[model samples]
Target chain A: MNLFKLAWKNITHNPLSLLLNMVLLTLGIGLISFILSVNTQLKDKFEKNLADIDLVIGAKGSPLQLILSSMYHIDAPTGNISIDEAKPFLREGHPLIKRSVPLSMGDSYKGYRIVGTDHSILELYDAKASEGRLWSNLLEVTIGSVVASNLDLGLGAKFQSSHGFNDDEDLEHEHGTFVVVGILEPTGSVIDQLILCNTESVWEVHDHHEEAESAEEEDHSHDDHEEHDHEHEHDHAGHEHSEYEHDNHDHRNDMSRSQLLEHGEKEITSILVQYTSKTNFQALSMPRNINENTDLQAASPAYEINRLYDMMGTGTRALQLIAVLIAIVSAISIFVSLLNSLKQRKYELSLMRVLGGKARTLLSLILLEGIIMSLLGFVLGILASQLSMAAMAGSLADRYNYEFSSWQWHGSEWYLLAASVGIGFQAAVLPALMAYNTDIHENLSDA
Target chain B: MLKTSEIRHSYKGTQRFTFPEIKCDESSSLMILGKSGVGKTTLLHILGGMFKPLSGDVSINGTSIYTLRGNNLDTFRGQNIGIVFQKPHFVQSLTAEENLMLAQKMAGNSVSTNTVHELLQQLNLDHKAKALSYKMSQGEQQRLSIARAIINKPGLILADEPTSALDDENCKKVVELLEDQSEQLKAALVIVTHDNRLKQYFKNHIELS
Candidate 1:
């Protein structure tokens, strides 16, 4: 503790130099902590939620996007296929296809990416809502923690989709509105950045899209009268269309048994399938075979994640190596400073030596000085890192759909602290040797 | 009381000293006089345990003090023996008070303001307590050095060229301070110098050849 006070006094005594050194040190440590924490948080999230699902079977164009979207909820999914096209496998139901969960992406509200998936997304992943129950009707949405916090949304809150990918475009989704029925807990994964609704909501939104646009135009012209703005023009456009089919939805729940045969491509973005286990390779192979032979393509999730890691893994490791090098350089700086002070403090050293101070005592004092400085530098590093994390929270959540926890010491924080202190103490070796020898007679003769 | 039995020391390739038996009894003063390079300073340093003689035995109060080596020797030197050098170097960062305090702390002295103040006033350095040694005049700095030497009230007081840089008046005052401290503390005083001015103050003197 006295060593810390002395180092602190020395640093504070030269405020300008101290400030310059601190700024450089903070930047170096700040960048390292940010990069390491982000990587760690991502590794943690992937290792947590993506455990059960071995491979993602989807209509894959870019296998990485397919995995990132269906598995991590980040990308825009590839187009959807027919349940008739989907029905063969649903009926085949190989043991490998433990359960197939269909996902209809491409629907969004405001800037929130909405995944039009069935309740199986929650069931397969073993996630539960903290606020309200799952979506029952079409046009209903379930928000995640980040979504709720960022958009100020909650259960029973209404929202309208923007035109593009998670952007608040001037034009809203032509469908009426989506009422938030549930809010998921903070999973600290990509899912927390999304807005989830039923697949039917996606279907219904497209169904009334053209009519909603036409009706909106009519209202704009009719708004000159200022009488019909409160008439719920949006609700009526989408409500009438659903009402026409409401009577027959129960019968049409299963597409193979549908009474009315629809025309054009049955609109769907993609289907995400999970297997019971890798041992059920026979069942999992059936879907891949079906997709390969049929219209859709089933890509493996493990392969995609591994490939993504391969693509980014090199650069990340390189950056981490650079951080380690910078830290080593900092340790060397400590060594140099301590070594310099030893020469200037010769008289002081001899004085203490003459006062019954052991050589080991002086050595510990120098070593303690280095450890204290490194620990202090590390503290400043962590603080700077957290501030950077906060600044990047929103954009990171939106882009990669990754969430960062508020800065605090975790299980491994102590390991980092210990490593820094060890580096500091070891760096003191050069100076420690000087103090250990101290040349008692040289200083004494001069004295 | 102090005694050196046949001490021998050499420097460079040629300089040598072979001292005969020497002694300083309790409550007495002894002066060793010689020209430059005649081992006057070397003998003083060896007695204070600053350097090891090539061959010799030194005893203080009948104890073989040479057995306590290195830093142990240093502690014994600070507490039991006080040395006044031809040139005294002070830590530039410390003030007059701090300078005295450092020596006092090393000697385990009580750090009494009265003792420090009296010493400062006797040396006419009371106004410079807060002033750094570098800021003081040479006479005042020499006086502070004397103050530092006696701060511990050591058993053996050794002074070398203590008056070399002083005016006659200041030299008399410095010698008076030394004489007063030696008697008050009942210490063995040994002065080594080429200066003849201090001959009048001491009763026992050795003219080194």
Candidate 2:
């Protein structure tokens, strides 16, 4: 009874062809939407976790890996740098430096990282304790909201940490068990997956480990040293301990073990630095100075992540280009189908003319068919993209502790809608014109 | 009333036709008989407003239909002229009733489903109202074609060899159906055909020599 109703009938008249056109269009649109959603979320997570850190001074290694391990908590650390080597950046009232938080990351509980740092990290994440209170002792620990929920840990729960960043519970440091004192609120950042403790607990656990290993070494070498040489062996062990202490000192005399534990641990993994101001000159010059002039390596999170983006952008751009190409090809397929159907419908169009149907009426009918087809395809495509995103949500949560929601409407989708409608309109042009200019007499007479 | 004055038409690189002028009153039927190449269909097209004669005018009722241009001409044609094309071509996707409704719609007239259903009932096709046109039998399709033509209640009815492909019995039935519908609606009926079998159906006949 109506043009649109007529168009719907015509499109449904050949269901297989309609399905073919819709599938091609859906695949193209679904791929593009998937890429857009992931790309937007990834960029958002990176920018958020970067969180105003200007430089990361860690042991000499790949700057990208250092940023990944410190800022993203996804990669292995670049060995360890002594606190003495990293002290200049963390000193009180140091020029060109606003604040720095040193990290000691050689442990994980379950699969979640157990980060050793100061309270400044809590301030960096704007963290609040939802249960109990922040860690106040050497062995007390505070778990992030995600870590607490994922591991099902609660207040007063005690768990040992593995020796390194690996998830193996067999390598757990049995000498010390960290007691959970607090659980943080959900921050929606990497902090939500961390178990935060002070650096002293990490040093103490490793120190006990080193003592156990040294005691076993003495048991093995007792026959070679004899009873009189035991005193000499004590002198040698004291010398070795002093040498280990000197690794963290710069010729300062009369240093205590507590001072060593506080400001000069034999090793701290990395330091997160913030400049005094955005316009500070050292932001540009300091990373270069440290990488070339000091034993430590400095990395700017922004620069390394941009490099990551550029590398990722190439693959994404290629995929996006392929998606666009598929869309264009589907448009052509629509055009071909329209043209083919027009040929078969010529006499029918002429019959409409005989029934007083205008040329423009026929033109509009064909165009309306194309528009209807495109609208159906667009709706299906959006649903397909959402389904794919939902399928990917679980793994993304497991791997990056990132949540992916499929319910958001992207602004880019408007452009996609326009593109689809435009393609439909464009594809209908020739067939509509052919229908418009049909010779009623010849067609009716021929039939 | 229907009238044509000095109508003529031609195909590019083919034959030309100069048609004889004719006139018919309401409730009357006229048959245009011709041989295979006499351009009977072309003359029908001209009278139905499907084509503009190279040099002539066709007036249905008091208005010169050829003088109306674009959609105005289409609207006039839809309101005043009904055409039954040979072979009963239709929008295959639509049902018989819907086709009639479409004719009324395209003519810019308000579609009345009651009127369509009533006409199909009177034409003995009410049982097949929802059947697709291509799925109908030959006799049923021809009747559906007649229903579509008379759905708008036009002042003139034009048929282009509506009975050419039928047998003697169906051909006579189709001719009677056209005449009866035209008389009932008080419209001038015109049939263009090369078939001699319809020569006895109408007394008002024009021979296209």
- Alpha-carbon DockQ of candidate 2: 0.70
For model 2, residues B1-209, the per-residue Cα lDDT tens digits are 99888887778848889899889999999999998888887888888888887788888898988888788887888888888878788898889889999999988889999999999999999999899999999999999989989999988998888998899999988988998999999999999999888888789899999
- lDDT by residue (tens digit), candidate 2, A1-447: 888899999999988889889998898888888899889888988888988888899999899999999988988899888777877876767788888887888888777887878777877778889999887566679999989988899999998888776678667777788999999999888899889887666765665655555566677775544543544544454444545445434532223334444555357789989888868776678889999999999999999999999999999999999999988888888888989888889988887776778889899999998888888888888899989898898777766556777867879889889988987898888899999999877777777
Reported per model, the fraction of native interface contacts reproduced equals: 0.12, 0.77
Off by over 4 Å in 2: A149-154, A157-175, A203-265
Q: How far is candidate 1 from the true structure (C-alpha RMSD, Å)?
A: 6.2
Per-residue lDDT for B1-209 in model 1, tens only?
A: 89989798877659888987889987799988889878876788688776678889898877667888655766677788877777766645567877777676655555577778888887789999989787898888888887888778788888889998888998998898888888888999999989999889888998888
Q: Residue A229 in candidate 2 has what lDDT?
A: 59
Highest DockQ model number:
2
Pairs of colliding residues, candidate 2:
none
For all predicted structures, in order, the TM-scores are 0.81, 0.89
DockQ of each: 0.28, 0.70
> What is the docking quality class of candidate 2?
medium
Q: Which 10 residues in a row give candidate 2 chain A its minimum summed lDDT? A: A251-260
